[model samples]
Each structure stands twice: as C-alpha cells, then as structure tokens.
Target: MAEPITLTAPNNTSYSQPTGLFINNEFVAAKSGETIETVNPFDESLIAKVAAAGSEDVDVAVAAARAAFKNPAWRGLSAADRGALLYKLSELCERDKHILATIDAWDNGKPYQVALDEDLAETAAVFKYYGGWADKIYGQIIETSDAKLAYTRHEPIAEQTPLSVLYLGTLIKEAGFPPGVVNIINGYGRTAGAALAEHLGVDKIAFTGSTTTGKAIMRAASVNLKNITLETGGKSPLIVFDDADLDQAVKWSYVGIMGGMGQVCTSTSRIYVQDTIYDKFLDRFKEYTVENTTSGSQFDEKTTHGPQISKTQQEKILGYVESAKSEGGRLLLGGKPGAEKGYFVEPTIFADTKNHMKAVREEIFGPFVVIQSFSSDEDAIEKANDTEYGLGAAVFSRDIVRAHKAAAAIEAGMVWVNSSQDSHFGIPFGGYKQSGIGRELGQYALSAYTQVKAVHAATCSGAHASPYRSGIISRNSSLDRGSILQAGDHVSPSKRPGAKA
Candidate 1:
C-alpha cells in the first residue's frame, strides 16, 4: 500500500495528501511502484511523490471496476439511494472546502482565496446539483392504442469506474460508495489515460482537455466504439459595444482571461471593442490591470494572480508572447514574468491585432488576451465568429435587445450578455465546432451518461404489422385511424438520419 504524505499550509494548518492510486476504495501503490512528483507551483518546490499508474495498473483498476459493476452493493442501489451517497459526498466537500482549496492553490497555482470562494464552492455545488437529479431521471411514455403500450427508458450508460480528483476518492469512500465504483489514478495522459480509453470493459468516456488530446482519446476509444464526450480547446471572443458599461466590461474582461490563470478552455482570449470606445477601453483596462491585480504566492493573503501550472506552461506562455510580438501585435501592457521565481507570468495584453495572427487564432491558454476594434456590429459579429472555436463569447450593452441580437449572431455554443466567465450549476456548459462534441452541467450532462431504450408491448397482435417497427410510417400518424399519436407530433422524415431537410 502507498502511504499518505503530510504538508503544512501557510496558515500553519497541516493535512495529509494521499499519495496513491485510489482503487477499490483503498489507496494502493501502482503495479510498478512508480511515482509522480507533485510540485507546489507557487515556489516551484517539491511537495510529494504520488503513485503513478501504467498500463498494467490501468488493467487492475478496470478489473476492479468491472467487478464492482456486477456486485449488488453498487448495482442494487436505488436511484434515490445513489443520490443520497452523492449528497453526502457534497456535504463532505463543503466541510473540507478549506483543505481542498488549499490543495488546489498549492498544486494548481491558483489563489487560495479564489479557490476557496469560487472553485471549492462550485465543486460542492456541482455535486449537489447533479445529486438532486438522480431521482428525477425519467423517461417519456408514448401514446399507444388500446391494448398496446409503448414507452422509453433512460438507462444508465455507466456502471463502472468514474474518474476524478486524488482527493475526491477519499471523499467518495467517506460517503459510503461501494469499492471500485469510482477509481482515481495519478499518471501521465499517455499510459493510464490511454489504457482506460481503449479498455473494452469501459463503456463510455468523458474527457476535458485540449482538442488534440480529445481527438487522441476518441481514436483510442474506437477499439470498443465507446460513447465519448469531449470538452476541448477554445479561442472564444468577448465583444464590448459602444453602449456597454465601460467599467463593468473592463473588469469582467480581466476576469475573462485571468481566471484560473487563463488555463480555462473557454477563456475569452479575443476581445472586440467598438471603435468609438476602443482607445478609452484600453486605457481603462490597463489602469484596472495595474490597480486591481497582484502577483505573489498563492498562500499570501494579498495575492490575486498566481503562477502557471508548471515550468513547461510558463515557458509556453512566454513563447506565445514572443510570437505575439513577431506577428505585429502591439503589446499594450505586461509581456514578461511577474516575478523572478516560480512559474509566474505577467497578465499580458496584445492590442491592434489582426484576426489571422497566432495570438488571435490559437488558444494560448495563458494569462494573455488580444484586443481589437470593430467599426460596426456586423464587423464585431464577423470577427467574433471568425475563429475555428465556438466555445463561448460575451456581449456587453445597455440595450438588452441589441445585446441579445449580437449574442445570437455569434457562432458559439454559449454567449453571455452583460457578464463573462461566470456560470451557474444549473446551466448547460460546453462548446461547438472544434471546441467540443457535447455539453456538461444541468440536464444535458445527465443525458451524456444515459442511454435511451424504447419498449413496445403488443397486447393486441397484428396491429397493422406493427407501427414504428419499420422505422417509418407509410401514412401520416395523425391521419391514420386508431393511431395513438396526437397531432403535431414530430415525425422522423426519412430512414437516412443524416439527410438535410
């Protein structure tokens, strides 16, 4: 078995960090006993070495999960019972929010305050929100003729291993979930992640990462034709109209690209301001950056800005800065390291940038943003929708009608009016085009883990050689005599589902 490593917080509080692969409700060493070093990004110092998973370890985890899926301890639970377990987990998360926030602050390089106030709060909310939906997982009953019954059932697509945080495993165990129902392993994406994606025993996969890696997972999952959901890369746009509240827009724009150190997939790295207030916006934005932002250790109470997740990430952001300079993008403010040590980068901005520039077209995934001016609403919409990514965009305007109009025109999966980056637990979150394949959060997320099954019971035999069995209705369902379908029913037009209307 692997042992837990202890660490002290800046506030002088101590906690044990579990340094093992959590499988079968226990923390155990990897098959090879290899370890991954967990570093504190605030100081670039060693924290502890956690057990690392290889392909062989993945096999063991998968086997355990398969057994648990069959075991009555997991399979026999009612939906409400399962939800109760999740609710207990949420309560545990709430109780330990401070410690969880501290772990993310040290390991992920986010400010402890924000992690506590925003990240941990949201984490607990997510679990509680989804837990509430467990008992409400309902299907529709179709209208069938007398002596006939037809309906559909939304069945669980997942029965085995669910992936999550190294800390979450402890929470799951504490919440009284069955062993192997949820497994977490620490390892690089190549070995353990790939093995899980390719495993035949796993029926589905939901991944949150870069578009490149999402594509790789899709390919590996092809071995079993596993159902997959990918939340991938983005270079989303945030537009500011001339009539917008200038201060609000400026402050939100800062939060847009600076939250999570701009590591968010839906970060609004591209901004379009109306030509009328372009210069003023930039001046105010620069002033706001100077006054409102701070860079330091995540443990420090004064710190607002934190370091990049790793040395590699810091270097990559720096490289993108150089690329911005070379591509004729004018630097407005902050284009270097914020401090002499750690993986800190200054909150950078590139103004007067062209749409074709790498700084605008690509997802830098750092605390960097490019600002541009638009002469007209048409121009703004066109510029915002020009990127291959359609993850998210924001529109700010005093006129709600105009704001909504512009929001509708933007070719993105989600759009915000008078706000940016802030999301609710009840909202569906995801992207379009290359940004992702499906949605998460709210009712949409429940669907991602569900499979629909249609049921047909013929109490009366020879009912016109069975309707809907041929996947086609020769006549209009409403016009047919004794048909149970009501008027205005949406009919499947043809056998070829992909055919355009």
Candidate 2:
C-alpha cells in the first residue's frame, strides 16, 4: 500500500496528499501495489507518489459503480436531491479553493494566483451550473397517431481513472454522496484509462487530452458502443485585422498562447495579422511579450508564466522550436529552455512562419506562438482553416458586421470577438473536425453524460384490446357506404387489403 506523502509549498503551507485510488468513497491502494512519482515542474523535485492503478483496479472501480448505479440509494434519488449534492460539492470546493489552487500550481505548474482566481473559480462555477441543470433535464413529448404517449429519461455514467479526475471524487465524497456513486483510480493512460474506456459496464467516457489518446479511447469504446465525448488537441488561430486595436490584439494574443504556460488545449498558437499593420503589430507584440512575461516558481506572486508540466513536455516543446527554425521560421525571441534545474521554456515566438511550418501545424502545448501575415480576409480565413484542427479561434476587428461574418466563417467550435481565452460556464465548449467530438460545459454536456430512453403508454378505450387491433381494418367494408372516408381510416396492409405489408 502506498502511504500518504506530505508536501510543503513555497509559502510553507503543508499538506498530506492522498496516494491511493478513491473508490466507493474510500481511498485505498491499487491492487497491483505499484506507484508513480509525482514531481514539481518548477524545481524538478519529488512532490509525492500516487498509487498506479492497473486493469484490476479499473475492474473494481467499474464493479463498484455498477453496483451503486443499481442500488436504489443512488438510482432512486430525485433529480433535485442529486442537484443539491452537486451544489454542496461546489460549496466545498470554494471553501478549500486555496489548497486546491496550491495543489494545482504544484502539480500542473500554472501560476498559483491564476489557478485560484480563474481555473478553480471556473471549475466551481461549472459544477454549480450543472447542478442547476440536474433537475431541469427535461424530455419532450413526441406527437404520434393512435392512443400512444411517449417520453424519455436521462441517466449517468461510470468512472474517470486519472489523477486529475480523482480530485472530483474527493469533492463528491465530501459533499455526502453515496458510496460508489463516483469512483476515481489513478494510473497511466495505457493501463487504467484504456481499461475504463473498454469496460462494458462504463456507459460513457468524457475525456480531455491529446488527439492521439482520444483516438485510442474512441477505438476502445467502439467495442461496447459506449457514449464518448472528447475535447482534444488544438492548433487554434487568432486573426487580427488591420483595423483592430493593436494593443488589445497583442494582449489577447499573449493571453491566448502564453497563459498557463500554453498548456491549454484551446491555446491560440497560430496568429494571423493583416499585412498592412503586420510589422507594427509584431514589434509591439515582441516588446510586450519580452517586458511582461515572467517565468519562475508558480507560487511567486510576480510570476506571469510557470514551467512546463514535465521534463518530457519540456523536451517536446524544445523539439518543436528546433523544427520551426529548421523549416524557415525566423526566431523572433526566446527560443530556448529557461533555467538549469526545472522543466521551463522561455516565452518563445517565431515570425515569418509559413502555414506548413511544424510550429504552426502541430500543437506544441507550450509558451510558443507563431505569427503570420495575411493580405486579405479570404487569405486569413483560408490560412486559419488550413489545419486538421478546428478548435477555438479569435477574430479582432472594429467593424461589428465584418467581425461577426468572419467568426461565422471560421471552421472552429468557439470564436471570440476582439478577445481570447475567455470561456464561460454557461457557454458550450468543444471543437470540430480532428479537434474533438461532442461538447463539454453548459447543458449540452449533460447529453454526453446521460442517456435518453423513450417510453410509450397505450390509452385505448378497452382494457383488453390488443394494441395492434387499431391498425387492422377490413379491406372491403366501409364505415358509411355513401360517405367519403378519411385519409387515416384507409387500410393498405396486405393482410387487410390488396396491398403489400
């Protein structure tokens, strides 16, 4: 069994992090008894070790979920009651926001203040929004002929067996949810994630990760035809017109790519500026980026950027930078690794990048931005849409009509007007094409998490009358010999008339 490990943040706040899989509202060691070390990206120091779940752990978690779903304690709960529980969980998250933020900063290498103020706040708000929707998941009544009435119902899914996902399980238990209602197991994607994706008992899978892994999950889930919702990789573009506010465009472009060390899936990595103001925009953007962007420990209050999540990620970002330079991309500023110890990359920018450049085509998932100049609106749209990815995008223009028109034409899921990286809990978030499938956030997310079942009830006058009897009518008989018959009253079945069944 893996023992809880104590971690102390730069602020001297100490915590005993859980090192076990959370299942049936209890934290327990993985059946395999293996562990994976969790390290801090800022200093490359060991933070803690978490239990590494395997196929057996996934099975246990799925079985627990299946049993809980079958239990009336969970299945019999009213939608309002379930919603109350979610609300309670959101409240608990808000209460412990500071600790959560610290953990996120240590684990994910995002600025602590930003994690607290933005990411954690948004997470809580999302839960609260979904809570409000729990009781309002209504199904419509379909119009049909004969004495039949139909309606539908929605249901929940099973497990998420990742370290990040386990945090939700902890919150759910704190909110007083029933045992096994939500299970969390921690391990590598190849073992735990694949097992959960292929599990027959798991009715749905909501994944947010790389497109490569998302494809694997899709293939695995195809075996059971499990419902899948994927929010995958993005090589998004931020288009700035000649008439746009230069300062606003520069700031938003920075936020879109450099925010969270560019680990966001919807980061605007490719930037297109109008040729008329291209040079001016590039000079100002470089100045702003160099002057404002700071990289260091996430806990430092002055740090605007943090280290990459892992050594492997840092290497990947560096590789992309080298590839960009080799492919004729001019390095504008900061194209190398940061400090000696940690997994940090300097805020890198490449100019005069072509559409075919690796830095523009692939998802670096680091603080790297590629700038390209466009001659016209058509050129900008064509370049932006010239990727397999169709995730988030941005358009900046003073003309409202032109901006909206460009936004509509962009081949992406979400588009921001004169802004970037601004997301709301109420708005639907997802991507198009290879970026992802289905949607997350808003009421649309409920569709992915729940299934709809149609139910029909017969309302015939006679209790013992067969439901098929109404459809059977005499071929040669007429209700009124001299009267005209209604369209529905005519029978066309071979069993009743001179027609094929």
Candidate 3:
C-alpha cells in the first residue's frame, strides 16, 4: 500500500485520509477487489479510492461480528470497560478532529469549518454521552411473587452495518475494542446494505437516511423479524407568528433550510408565516437568504454553503425548483444553478406555495425552501400537519404560552419554540409518522442498539411450578376464575375442589 498522504485544508490544517474499508480492527480491501472513487464535491476531484464491498464481503463482516458477539472476550467485558473504551474513542476523535472533519467535508460536501466545529464535535459528544450510559443501563424488577425473581438485560445487536457507519469502525478499533466486535463494510444500498438488512444473523438495524430507503430496510428486516430503528426523510414545518421577533425568525429559518446545504433530514423546508407580516417577512427573508448563503468550495473559509453531495442531488434540487414554478409558486429568489463549476445550487426560495405543491410536501434535500401565508395559528397548524411526514416543527412567537401550545399541537417527533435545527447530544432525536421509527441520541439511542431480554428465576425450592402449568379449580377454591393462584394460596392441581381424583 502507498504511504498515507496528508492533505492541507483552506485554514492550513492537515489531515491523513483513509482509503480502505475497516473490518475486524484492520483496514482491508474488498474480497472482490471492487473500488468506489470518493470525489471532492467542490471540484469533483478524486479524494480517495474506497473499497466497495459486495454481498459476499458483507457476509464476511457479519460473520466476524457474530463470532465476536458470541466470544466472551468482547461480550463478557464489564460495562465499565465498555464505557472506558467508548470514552477512549471520544478522546481519539477529539485528537484527530481536524482530519475527521476534513474527510467528512470532502466526502459529504459540507463546509470544512462547519464539519469540524459542529458535526465532528457533535459526534464526539454523542460517543461521550453514550459512554456515560454504558454502565447505567438498568432494568426494573417486576412485582411478582417473593418466590420468583424477574429482571432484564440489554444486549447489543450483532452485525448490520451501514454505508456511512464504516467511518466509526476505525475509532472503535483505536479505542481498543476487541476485533470483530465492530465491523465496517462499504457498498451501495442495493448490495451491501440489502445484505446486512436481510442477514438473519443481524439482530437489529439502525438506519438514518431517506424514507424510501428506510422503508426498503424495514421490508428486508421483516423477513427475520429483526429489530429496526429508522431515522428517515422529513418535510418539517417552521411557523413564524406576527408576534415573533422577525429578525430572529428570519435568521433561524434561513439556518433551518440552508444549513447543511439542506441535506439534513429535519430541515424545515415548509415555512409558514402569519398573514399580518407575511409579505414583510418574505422580503427580509429573501434578502437575508440571498446575502448570507454563499455557495462554493467546501474548504473555502467564506463559503457558508457548500456544493451538493453529487450531480444527481443537484439535479434533483433543480428539478424540485422547476416543479415548484410549474405549480404556480412564485420564486422570491435564487432558483438557478451556481455560475461556477461543480455540483452547486443557489439557495432557492419560493413564495405563494400551497400545501399540495410537490416542493412544499416532499423532501428536496437541498438548499430550497417553500414559503406560504397562514391566517392564524390554527391555519398554520393545519397546513403544517397536512403532509404525511412529521419529523420536526418549529414555532416562533413572543407569547411563550402560545408558542408552547402551538409546538405541542404540531405532529412531529421534535418541536422547537422560537428556534430551528438546534440539537443536543443528550436530547432524543427522531421523527413521527413516516419520518422515522424509534429515537436516536440520548438514552433512547441505547434502546435502539440493544435488546431487552427478561429472565425469571425461582427463589424457593417448593415454588418451582412453571408459570404456564395447567391447573384445575373449583368455585369455592381461593384460585381466581382464570386459574391463577391467589397470593399465598398455592393449591395443587390434584387437591383442587374440582379435581378428578
């Protein structure tokens, strides 16, 4: 293999890049020797050549994970040890923050600074937060008979790797986790992803991507009844009341749609403003969006918005803009491709959009937003909840009580009052309705990664009767009508009043 090459960022920071799949604590090539070119979105230059895993390779990775899960060397480790390893991984990420951020920026088409300061920072914080929870995963004891004891144990799901999940496998290895405990395989959704989801050995699948893809995974997982946690696409709504601070609402709304190049699943693409200040807000919102959203290279220090992830995504966003215009929506500003090269689209805004418009209801997954006017809070709520998606919603109002009420009424997994896209490591993140299934981050994420198994044990030698044992009873007996033995009244089946003896 060639020596690792260091690339310099716009800020003069250096990063050493990885070009291979990480599996069983080692960087290796795909068994089929297939490769996928990782391109820099800014110039479409080859950043690295990643090993493209196929179904066979996925099987190998899954087998390794299964073996490791069964091996006491990993599964038998104390929770404290597991937590310590995660903490070590967090530290390693912190030390290599610059390199990790550069890699993400190059691959994902996000600004370098934003990747470093926000995405990488949040990732590290997530590891640390989950690390603290490793030893605290406790189960409740049921109030059964004193002679019987029942408790639960949380166990990690085996295998089931994701496309982007390979990025974290190196960190797991660096943290001194046992080999095979966390395996990474990279490939397209049809091959490697499908294989992982359908593999019977996999106990669970935690997926974060488009709703269409999430549905596919769910279907595949159903074959084996595997546990699934999906965080899917969204068409979240942002409501700006007349009582809201216009400046704050405008700024936050801009950040909500334009941030991450509108690639976030929870981007508030559907915006509603109270009719009283609708025109005024749109004017300022358009001006602010045009002035602030600077699209260019990911490494550019002044670039607030980077190029879309790929040519297809850029075309997709542009297509949505065309659809919006075709639907009679008025373009307020920026409805064209970037003047320069690369997959860049200007931050686009549309007004006079209806709830039924495709651009307003669907997830464009780009720097595009649709704005509409609402007569009152009820109207805004109705419009926001009109879509099938219910991932996230935001309410901007000076009246705290009204804002909270509006937020509560919105049909979404998350609600923000006078804010947008502000997420925390400890906060549970997920969606409602078709947006996703189950929650991620915080303690809720632990539930996704683990399975709950209950155990019942008999504490008394004479109380060894099986809970499912059949019995006979009489009307005069202390046993309940359902044949359940009353507390402190265990009756032998043969000694029952209606016994055949």
The C-alpha local distance difference test score for the whole of candidate 2 amounts to: 0.85
lDDT of 1 by residue, 357-456 (tens): 9888988889999999999999999999998889999999999999989988998889988888988878999998999888889898888899999997
Q: Which ten residues in a row have the lowest lDDT in candidate 3?
A: 158-167
CA error at residue 133 for candidate 3, angstroms: 0.5
Q: Please write out the lDDT profile of model 2 over residues 1-501, one tens digit for every residue.
A: 345567677767676666788889988998878877877888888777778889999999999998999899999999999999989998988987887888888787888899899988988887888889989988878755456667787756511113345556667888989999887787889888989899998888889899999999999999989989998999999999999999999999999999988989999999999999999999999999988988888999999989898899899999998899999999998878879989899999999999987788889999999999999999999999999999999999999999999999999999999999898888889999999999988878778888788876657654445434434343345532333346777653544433345
Q: Where in model 2 is the C-alpha error above 4 Å?
A: 1-3, 157-168, 462-501
Of the two candidates 2 and 3, the one with more favorable TM-score, higher being better, is 2
Error of 1 at 13 (Å): 2.2
TM-scores for every candidate against the unseen true structure: 0.91, 0.91, 0.90
Candidate 3, 44-116: lDDT as tens digits:
7766667788888888888888888888988899999989988999998898787777767777788989988
> How many pairs collide in each candidate, listed in order?
0, 0, 0
User: After superposing candidate 3, which stretches have Cα over 4 Å from the reference?
Assistant: 1-15, 158-168, 464-501
